[model samples]
Target: MSYLFDHPDKVMPFFWEHVRLTFTSLLIALCIALPLGFVIAKYRKLQAPVTSVLGIIYTIPSMALYAALIPYTGLGKTTAMIGLVAYAQMILVRNVVAAIQGIDPMMIEAAKGMGMSKRQIVFRIEVPLAVPVVLAGIRVATVSIISIGTVAAWIGAGGLGRLIYQGLNHDHTGKIVAGTVTIALLAIGADLLFRIVEKIFSPRTA
Candidate 1:
């Protein structure tokens, strides 16, 4: 409490860094996942292999991944962001594939029967239908990123985790509490935000 109360200037910056890191990683993951998911989902045959590889990547421990990346990317933000992005891939891509694949085949057939081109069908029918499920995946991935972002501080990526590790090193209970509490709140905030979004898109709500 004292650490946070007395050091708002200090703690707040880290809080925002954590936010930035999380958003950046998710954005990157989404950009990559969205297209790749669509491609693999379209082919159908590609889905199993691509997702399997991503699943394996996600299973590796974050620390090991970071350690492996550090050699190539060096320490600091690059290494951290790469690691975060990699960990996020399995969740984002799988969700995207699931989202697109979950759409009713009849809806697609109707779109085609209406003389809709592939581009039109994709943009009009597929994208809208996929958004809610993708949002759910984003909600899950966001929390995962927030949790992983803490470990990122160890690599100098700079986030709330800095306070945590630093506190451990210095035996400062206040720093640990501040970091942990803020992280929990951030995760909760993301979850709720996406939940509202999911509800908005849901047919049930309409």
Candidate 2:
């Protein structure tokens, strides 16, 4: 409480930094995942190999991935963003594949019967139906990125995690608590926002 009141400037800046890192990485992941996921889902044969590689990347420890990236990208947000984007790939790609593939085959057949081209069937029919699933994936990835963005502080990326690290070094309990609570709240808020969006895109059940 005291720590937060005393340092509103520091707290707010770091919180926004954390937001920037999380959302930027997610945007990159979505851009990469959507096209790749579409191709993999469409071809069928590419699914095993491509997703296997992304899964292996996701399995790597975050710290290890950061350490490996630092030599090339060096310290700062670039390296952190790369690591975070890599982490998001498996989640986004898999969900996208599932969403597109899960669409009703009958709907697709009908689209074809109506003389819709492959592009029209994909953009108009499949992509719209896949929105809920993609939003689900985005929700999961956002939470994960919020958690991971804390570690970005270690590499000088500047986030709420800095408070935790500083408090650990200086033994400032208030700062540590503030950082932890802030992150938890941020994750919860992001989850709720995405849940609302998912529901909006979800099919009506009535």
Which pairs clash inside model 2?
none
Tens-place lDDT digits, model 1, residues 4-120:
888889899999999999999999988898899889888999988988899999999999999888888998988988988888889988888899989999999999999999999
Off by over 4 Å in 2: none
The list of candidate 1 runs beyond 4 A from truth reads: 204-206
The per-prediction tally of clashing pairs is: 0, 0
Model 1 superposed RMSD (Cα):
1.2
Residues 42-130 of candidate 2: C-alpha lDDT, one tens digit per residue? 99999999999999999998888899999999999999999899999999999999999999999999999999999999889999999
Q: Which ten-residue region of model 1 has the weakest summed lDDT?
A: 197-206
Candidates in order, TM-scores: namely 0.96, 0.96
Flag clash pairs in model 1. Answer: none
Q: State candidate 1's TM-score.
A: 0.96
Error of 1 at 101 (Å): 1.0
How high a TM-score does candidate 2 get?
A: 0.96
